[model samples]
Target: MAVARHVADTVLFEGYVLYPYRASATKNRLRWQFGVLVPPSWTAVAEEHDFQRTELLMEPRRGATLALETRFLHAGRRTVQRALPDGGFETVPELRLDDRVLVPWDEGHEEQVRLTVAVDELAGPGVVVPFTRPAAETTEPVTDKAGRVVGRLVRRREEISGVLRIVTGELDGPYTTRRLSVVVENTSDWTPAEDAGRDAALSRSLVAAHTLLCLDAGRFLSLTDPPEWAGGEVARCRNLHTWPVPAGEPGTEDLVLSSPIILEDHPSIAPESPGALYDATEIDEILALRTAALTDEEKREARGTDDRAAAVIDLADSLPAEVLERLHGAVRGLREVTTSGTPRTPAPAAGMPDLGPAAPWAGAGGADGAPRPDTPWWDPGADASVDPAHDHVLVGGRPVRAGSRVVLRPRLRHTDAQDLFLDGRRALVEAVLHDVDGGVHIAVTVEDDPGADIRREQGRYLYFQPDEVDVADPGEAS
Candidate 1:
């Protein structure tokens, strides 16, 4: 089960939420391929003639060689005359975004736009222009007007399109340098295809070059890999995510580069490393609505076309029956944890492998393969603490020791914790534990509650990552 949870994490690792999750995000509408070198004309800009410069963070190790593979698309453009209301003649560049680049331009000035793509490699104060096309014979030192040698112009040719490879010697390791750019410059005077013709004129121009930076396997495995003990689990988690690399030729080893790292802005990970990508509490609440029991009027509200409720209802219906049943059982267990009641652990469904050994902390069964009588799931006796002597753990960037006041910071999703452990409300950090997967978690007992024998009930402690808590100074912990 723990392994299964890691597998789920792997699947949700990349492309889970796109750059802009909502349709309202207009600024991030276009999906730009990472590190792609494309003609300036293909991009949308208020000003004319600008190249799309892609910058990526490079983590190159010391004493290791590197190989960079770049793939680009070929786009055909034509100069067309558009009549303006002011009677001025304007030559508009039209790009074929689709496969119809062979059709004659509207004004018959059709020509395959010849382009020169160049890659500049930089580290520390040094620069190397290792690749360019069409090849350059007479080369001169080129720098941005700022007098920086930046990178060499590898090649400049009239007709060149496809994958380019640049291999380099061992790079100086143990370094972090942002040359600010590993520039891929397309120096051509072609205009981007108009948006109106984009759907039909999809050509090489529409696709951007995908650059891959790979290191020698031997060197990379030894120096940069995570600790050996955790390597198999990490690989298991990553193996869940299988992104397809774009292939240039059928048998070619070089493929389009893709990354699991979320390069864009996103919320920080919860300190606890909640195994699932979603809020289980919210899912439980939605499940509690019971779509099968809704009245016609309530059904209309559940299926309302305008908002998120309809989507939630749809998702609930689409989910497997076994999943909903498991969720129901989970929520019931949670209810038992918050209350001063003894909740008997449920038996494993028929044919399902026992998860008790994989997740010793779950404490569902004892060594004899029988339910542990009267044992709280959150009890420390289930698994030995990695650091029990330390009375406090770091929470919200502050050291919050046990017995100190803390506040809940549950996620924005609809959750039962929001009501029980309201944000900004003070709570008590009773205990802290580090799980088998090396994640730190703290058990919090709410300061104010309506329950029987809260202190005596071992199940009353709620666990969360340190990030979800803050120090509740003096009076805050009433």
Candidate 2:
């Protein structure tokens, strides 16, 4: 559960702040872009959603029970008020006292609701858990070094309401599995005025909403890659706005995280990550280095923006040399080459000799220990046995080489959306290539395309694996 929490936290605060972390940044103006559940009244005007649905397959044993935890952020408006000379205070965007600065901003408050239910109880109407958080306001007097009231900070939160509904149904199949569905909806009754803007809606919305499920005696199946027997059942599960994936440590199926962001099974944080920068998609090393280079004024503004932003500035300033080095990069899963000059995996084809214990550019001799400088490893001309112009690959037990015709069948998972348009299109094989990873690729040009010759002359062609293409009619081969 701890490991899963780390990933969930990352998803929760993703895009909470962008690079620079300053409130003045244009990109930071529009926040809370992920997993937002606005009120039902605003749905019609804004085309935004008020609910999120998550469905998953679970196999439970006798007396199996499930625990669910719903987490989100409650937004609040923070305004800075300046002390008047007489007695009244006026609203101000920024207030400063000594070295500290305060700015008006929308802050997020973390909220969580948890409940445990027995598997047997979810058979009929299931269960409904209604939760609400009341609105509140607080004020903090900001005083200068002279102990005189200089200004004050006012924070106000709007009432938030939501509901979590869970239901289960027995799957009709040979396997004893059941489909569990959970829906999180914002039931706040507040309706905005005619001219109410996004700020008004955000105050009552559930920001960054997500759910975590833990089973006491059951295992959750993987929707991305399910067993052959349960493939049909898994396909029928309808997940909307959110995706359910296996969580916790690798190989642990007792916990599940349904998040608005799509993630692979068993997602974990990188060890080199120092802390949350809010923008999870950016490289940490780059963000840290860039953050460390901010100007003094920029850093000050960032710190005064929000507490989280201040923490980020402090982290960048205090990172140790050793920790910064670790953030540079780390590689994993590469097999170690044996000292006897043989790789654990199979050697390359007969013509391409292994480079032995030393790298080809190490100034050492070839695998046979004979000096050869004219043909460097990087130059393709160094290998006389390999020629892409005449190379051939087997497809459907038929040889497919240069000038051969084929029909494209790009895979949905591996190919982009635009590549789907090329499906069933006839193409002329231009060449066969092999990557350093030993994967084969077939380059082709659309046969009916008017610019086929121009593209071929420019040395540009669409590439695909053998399985993604089928041999055309023998008569069509040139």
Candidate 3:
């Protein structure tokens, strides 16, 4: 099983409870989450915008001494470097508590938590409410009139939203609870200078760019089920969140942008990478790559070795020059690390596989006129096959005949190794028949057009289209 990462550090933040209530004891395995907002320092890309809306899930602690830790992430900064010049903070139950929230003084700090503390002490009254909500939001950092970095925006909300059940306890009378308006406020701070022109302009652009990017990306991804998520607007006015500029104090100004920002963590949208254009096709394995992780473009200019040159030349024709150039380079780079018998490495451990592996064989029999021997299925050499007719595998309301050709459309997948790529790539397949052999739909054999052999090629692999693919007999009506 993949290990869950537990991040810890020091950091400043702003956020609060959406709604709070006394969680009933009957709430089995009650989940506690603490989400907060932090400031953004640099862009996710140069000339490209990136916003920070950091959130953390807080678990119930045993004592009064509550320590909050957060995952401190910076686009390109090293953990050690950021810790030196500017220390970091992990989110916990420490920030605010009706002004009476206190912690042990470690040397010159009022932050660190001591050994053991009481639950009531750390979670006094409604204090634990804001500290435990799944949230992640960001505010534009304040810049000086000259466009240099200046101040930052802060937010503190004490609202709650949850359900209540008597569970065995009785209320004095009909109890009432409140829910915060879905409308969230977009806020940041700015030092109003005598010449606030640059400051004002920057602020406007920041908000406009953020709103435009979020809404535009959200809509675009919705078209094909994008892997990344941020925020969005809802149908009702409740989605209209009320926000204020930190220094502006409840008053709004230029570049005002508001919408529900849905924050999430995605492996597909690695903070250091870009989006992909094509789906699973071997024609150009460039979509899921992390360019920033590369040293430079010069290193990208790779040459095929004698062993690989043949494979390159073999696959060039259908590959298109640009595609071959990239795939060949990628394969060569991984030759040393990837073993011949072993499958590809660094595959998206989370996303559905472009091609699934065969299932273990249930039979204990073997060929060559030998006696059947009982053996474990895990043995790689074991063969597994299933009879579709008996299994009720449907095809035209009946079992499909063997060795029949049925045109079908594949789900969107980019077979290319690199993920962050531009569109118009294709995946290849060998002409075959229908059968569930080796516990897989062996009828379809996905192939890769190496692009290595083609001279001055200008072709692309297949891309997915929902309304396009159909599975019918070769002689059937169109």
Candidate 4:
């Protein structure tokens, strides 16, 4: 559960704030963009949704109990006020007290609701858990060194209500698998006016909502790569907005995390990460280095923006040399390289040549088993065989080179969301390139694109692997 929670926290605060972490930044103006569950009224007038559903397949043993934890962020408005001589406070965007400065910002308050139910009980009507948090406001006085109250910070939280419903149904097959469905809906009664902006709707919404499920007995199956027997059942499982993935240890399946972000099974945080920078996609090493290079005024503004931003600034300023070095990079594993730029394996009888121990630059060392000082690995001129313009790859038993026409067929597991749009689209192959790791990639431009010629002229084309595309009209190309 602890390991799963660690990964969930990353999802919870993703994009909480972008780099620079200042309120003045243009990108930071409109926030709370991920996993937001707004009121139903706003959904009628806007594109945002009001609910998220996650369905997974589980095989439970006798007397197995399931525990569910729904977690989210409740948006709060923080207003900075300055005390007037008449014993009243006036709302201000920024307030300064001695060395500290305060700024008005929208903050997130963590909210969690938990429930446990036996697997047998889930056979009937299942379970319903309704939770609510009432509206509240608090003020903290900001004083100087003399302890004189100069201003105040008022934080207000809007009332929020939501429901978590769980149900189970036996899957039809030889297996005893059960389909578990969990729905997290925003039941907040507040209805915004037609012209009300996003800020008003977000106040009563569930930001970054996610669910964590654990079973005392039995385990959950992987929806991404389920067993052959459960493939049909897994396909039948309907998941909306969120994706369910196995959590906890690498091989363990007792815990599952249903996150709004897509993730592979058993996703773990990198140990080299110092902490959350709110921008999960960016490299921490680069962000840390960039943050540490901010000017004094920029750092001050970032610190005054939000508490989390302040913590990030402090973390960047205090990271040790050793920790920063670790953040540079990490190598998971290494593979042996043959004379040809491919993974080493037993030489075949016909095609491959037996270079023996005298192969040049073989195994990261020269023929004498010593580091080759004359030839460096990163030198591109050292390898003369890789010519993108002349290189070609075989697809559908046909040689595909530049000007070859191919149809995109992106693999489901290895593609991004944007690549789905390119599926089945006809493209003209521009080049067949190879990476430093000996992987072949086919670069192409969409045939119907208006700027295809411009992109080709600029040497900017979409790249796909050899298997991700199919040769079109082999006879015509030949």
Assess every candidate by TM-score: 0.31, 0.73, 0.25, 0.73
Q: All models: lDDT?
A: 0.37, 0.85, 0.22, 0.85
- How far off is residue 307 in model 2, in Å? 0.4
Q: Model 3 over residues 33-69: C-alpha lDDT tens digits?
A: 1111211222211232223221111122232122221
Cα error, residue 257 of model 1, in Å, equals 4.9
Query: How large an RMSD does model 1 have?
Result: 17.9
Number of clashes in every candidate structure?
A: 17, 0, 69, 0
Choose 1 or 3, whichever is better by TM-score.
1
Ten residues in sequence with the least summed lDDT for candidate 4: 347-356
**Candidate 2 runs further than 4 Å off:** 86-88, 145-148, 335-433, 436-478
- The C-alpha local distance difference test score for the whole of candidate 4 amounts to 0.85
Q: What does candidate 1's lDDT look like per residue over 138-212, in tens digits?
A: 223324456644222221223333322222222233443221233334444445445533412223232333233
lDDT of 2 by residue, 1-478 (tens): 5658999999889898888998889998899988999999999889789999999899998999999998999999989999999977999878865554678889998999898999989998999999999999999888888999988889999999999999999987677799999999999998799989998999999999999999999799999978888888888999888999999876778999999999988888888889999978889989899999998888888887888998998999999999999998996323223323334344442324455666554664656655544445334454565567898999999999999999888854456886768988899999887654567889999988999999999989999899999899867643
lDDT, candidate 3, equals 0.22
After TM-score superposition, the amount by which residue 171's alpha carbon in candidate 2 deviates from its true location, in angstroms, is: 0.7
